[model samples]
Target chain A: MVGIVGYGAYIPRYRIKVDQIAGVWGADVQSYRKGLLVEEKSVPAPDQDTITMAVEASKRAIKRAGIDPREIGAVYVGSESHPYAVKPSGTVLAEAIGACPEVHTADLEFACKAGTEGMYLAMSLVKAGEIKYGLAVGADTSQGAPGDPLEYTTAAGAAAFIFGHDKILAEVVETYSYTTDTPDFWRREYQYYPRHGGRFTGDPAYFKHIIGAGRGIMAKAAIKPEDIKYVIFHQPNGKFPLRVGELLGFKKEQIEPGLLVTYLGNTYSGSSPLGLTATFDIAKPGDLILIVSFGSGAGSDAFLFRMTERIEEVKDLAPKTRETLEGPKVYVDYGTYAKFRKKIRKANE
Target chain B: MPTPARYWREIPQRYRLEAGRCRRCGFIAFPPRLICPGCRSREFEIIKLAEEGRVISYTIIRVPPHQFVDQAPYAVGIVELDDGVKLMGQIVDCPFEELRTGLRVRIEFRKIMEEGEAGIIYYGYKFVPA
Candidate 1:
């Protein structure tokens, strides 16, 4: 059976406080920071594109895997935030990593869950024996308009996974998915920040969809929430998962590994898969991991992974996910974030 | 020098630096191509960019394209212009060591390189910290 051999994650350095937003808007800071539980969120620099983030993550994944580039046969990128819509991000990634040129490749997009969603695809392709090995990358440098609430939360980061029929750290035991025309959040064309149903998304959208998907998979696999050692959910903010997880009987211990979004912010497409990689960093051999992803167009994917004997073997990866969180920041004020997100027009600077 | 036809493929950038903003997806292309990469739409409006920004990240070209070998050791950075557009160019008019990650820079048309060995010049935009 094919499974994940190596994993890596990347989060950008910048952070913005909701209080800063509150400061600019002259809104009440006590309410924003206290309620949001966000001191800052990340932002990607101008030079740092999704391509580079994937490349950076791939470098770590490759190093962790210790696989020769020539041995790989495929590459897949899943993102809602690709740099060039047509120029395959997978192709650029292959070049960036010096992967063998003849690799079978393509890019994938399924909104925010695309990263882990791509992993499921790669697992299928690799298990089919159509390819000996493969790589899947999910990355996004999400944008938010100046002084907007998202400006304090929309962030940047990436994660990559190497799938092969080799020393498996985690084997794909069972998988499930729930998708619908759930457009709880969306950004219209040429808009910097996305439009959400607001409180509507909080109730029947995020909490309902994420828990429904997670609970559905647990039932399908005949596993209770107690059977899984950890749970990784797509995080858009600090409270959503905690609230939903509790309603579903999961404590902080079960979701701690996936709580990265509070520090890194919403990575859009990279959110859930990144949480999975972080869980892998501490997971013991023989542990079981349950993963779920939610995106606003809206959809969710659930997967159950069983850590194998190789789990510890692959643990010595460069810049552990926690260390990588200690970023190399490109701290920008509201104006720069606006320009980075391209919400404002310059007269001729 | 006139932009080569090959370069005009991204007209808003090569000619006018007009980024194509997706009416549906809200993505902007720097070397404004006709299609929006974000949502694959054809609708857009011209917006002038602020030619000033900061060096979010950059690298020194110890090894560069064949055309820029003479300018090795120069800094090339991605600057976030005031208009929310990010542009890439060499950082000129300052000591390379002084060019910090968040340095403020303004864009100006300058000679990037010349193909005609020692006698000709080619001009393009380069960043100078304001």
Candidate 2:
């Protein structure tokens, strides 16, 4: 069976604190940690966008797999924000990945689940002998309204996975999915901030779908909650995943390693895969991992994976905290955050 | 007024912070190139850089570009920008004795050189102490 040959993740160097957003809005006083379920979030520089992050992650994934990029037969990008509305992000990615000209190329968008959805598709292709190898990537730079809690945690990042039949880092054990049509979160055409059914998002939609998906996968695989070595859930905040995990019987240790959403906040599409990559960093050869994704407006995909011996050969390829993300913040005033988010227009000189 | 040949291709960058970058890694070439040394992607992005950078390395340009002859004894250094990009430009407004790695400098738009005898007055961004 085809499986994850290699994987890599990226988080930009800059992070913003949720309290910083609260201080600017003058809203009800709340702990930043409680509000966004995030303490800090990553920010990409002007030049670094979804494409650049994908390329960086792709390079690392390619290296970890120890395969020539030209050997790959397909490239798929899963992103909400493509640089040019008309341009193909997959083509730029293919060029960067050095994929052969004969490869198939495509871009997929299924909110947050698109990354793993692409992963499964790649597995099917490579498994069926349609292609020698395939690449799947999920990356995004979501916009949050300035002063809103989402602004504090709606950060940027990328993660890429390569799938093939041999030398797999982790073999796919079982897969299950629970999809639904719920308006938990959504953005319309030309809309900057996503319109979300706030209460609906946190409780009924996210929790329900995530819980359902995890349970479905667990039940289908006949693997009890204790059997999972690591569980990575789509992180909108620090609390949701923990809540879902506990309700489903996964203890703190099994889920703690991937809770970057608590610190780096919600990276939209990048969150779940990056969380998985983090889990892979500490995983042992026989470890079984479960990853669940929650995308607003809304669906969930759960993946069951077992680590392979090759994962131990190179341990350094994993998601990490950037030094800038650790730097002392500037304690940005509301005006500056507004400028940074392009919320307010400043008059020209 | 500008001469035809100089006006068409290489004239402008001779005066400022314009350079070609590797289409692949986005690494900018200093004396810009037709082919990027980084990844060698034939295609490239053209950029007008911010002049101010930290002194990555330095030397007094005791020998100067022909156009900069009158500006002898000038200090030259490689400055890495706050943006994590590195580029080369003359270090102005600070004495040669003061220039060192990690020194803060600001970019000022100015003329770097002009071709002799009937060249357009060149304009470029140069680094000055912030």
Candidate 3:
């Protein structure tokens, strides 16, 4: 019954409202508000990046796990915005949490699904008895081009999960993955911002993969939507997850707790993992949770988890997802956001 | 070019807030000293310094060094940790005017500096409002 032993999430303090971003490009704010269902998105401080956020979240996870950091045998970080192109984010995270010298670490990228990929690998390794404990993190300081539609939602945040055989908070019952070669969104090497296929990112991409994995996992686990207490889908936006949930026979109530994109925006690799963290915040013992993550290269990784009594003990060990989302947020105007995002060009040094 | 070895050697302190506490006099040293200055103790225990602290003094760097020109006007402060170890770091996530002696803060991992646009990024601890 290898599963999550501890989990933690981190959201930056700074935020930029949807209207503020819309006003810059003279886009209709009401359309985005009504359509995407995103209000404001988190922004990372200049000093914060993928690695920094991952380290913070992993620290909280270590605290919650209450296990010796030296016991962790593997560290994997999933992010599209890793600070160094070559250096692994996992190594820094491992060192920060005092898990160095004995840990195997790697950085993963599959767009938004990268985090779940790490989760899948870590859980599998733990289940196989290949490691005593494994740490997986999904985090990103996602990039969007200036005045591009992606700018409104591309945001920063991170979530980490520690997998082990003992003290399981949520027991992994089943796992499923659906993937294909779909070029819906991509950023070329040396490109600062990603380019997307716009409407092409829908139906054939996010929806198809998510529904395939969601239904596939439900079938493999031999459970109906009514049997699950909560469902979290990779939330590129508030609308997509809701619509997809309904399509998968889940009610609005079951999906709403994890529907954080309305406030947190799209944190890329952090999206679904953060949602699962939020669901874990309120889920009870014996509750069933289904988390399905979608990445732009076009794939979904779905996992079915059954909560254990230990969930109560560690849910409050770190900052709750909702508390951080609704905590004291420093709102930045578009100009400040541009500066923070480093949109303005400067002369050569 | 800045030497990576210099940065590499400080990983224990920079990444984990590791310090050396003298076994004889209980003097705590950041960067983990080889010999205790207080009691001349050669033996020590490596420990992590307290993460939470309070500002004892601070100065706003309005004109920063070459590497930190963009981050000028930031507040740098000396902090006294709960364990009595004093250290200097940048104070962030608060208004400059709000900073004062005795304000509570906690250490957070952050990017301290990077070498130009394409070099090794140095990460360390910074103070944030607790």
Top TM-score prediction, candidate number: 3
Task: Pick the winner on DockQ between candidates 1 and 3.
Answer: 3
lDDT, candidates in the order shown = 0.74, 0.74, 0.94
Ranked by DockQ, the better of candidates 1 and 2 is 2
Interface RMSD of each: 12.9, 13.7, 0.5
Listing every candidate in turn, what is its Cα RMSD in Å to the true structure after a full C-alpha superposition?
13.8, 10.5, 0.8
Tell me the DockQ of each model, to 2 decimals: 0.03, 0.05, 0.88
lDDT of candidate 2 over A6-115, digit per residue (tens): 88776654556666667667765466666556766776643356776777688678878888787789898887776656657787677645574778988888777778
Residue-wise C-alpha lDDT for candidate 2, range B49-130, written one tens digit per residue: 5545677887887787666665677877788887667767777646577788888886543345545534544434466665
TM-score for every candidate vs. truth? 0.73, 0.73, 0.99
Evaluating just chain A, the predictions reach TM-scores of 0.93, 0.93, 0.99
Across residues A191-210, which tens digit of lDDT does each residue of candidate 3 receive?
99999999999999999999
User: Worst lDDT window (10 residues) for model 2 chain A?
Assistant: A321-330
**Where is the poorest 10-residue window by lDDT in model 1 chain A?**
A340-349
Which one wins on lDDT? 3
- The DockQ-based CAPRI class assigned to model 1 is incorrect
For B1-130, candidate 3 gives per-residue lDDT tens digits of 7779999999999999999999999989888889999999899999999999999999999999888888878999999999999999999888887899999999999999889998899999999988
Candidate number achieving the greatest DockQ relative to the actual structure: 3
Question: What C-alpha lDDT, on a 0 to 100 scale, does residue A97 get in candidate 1?
Answer: 66
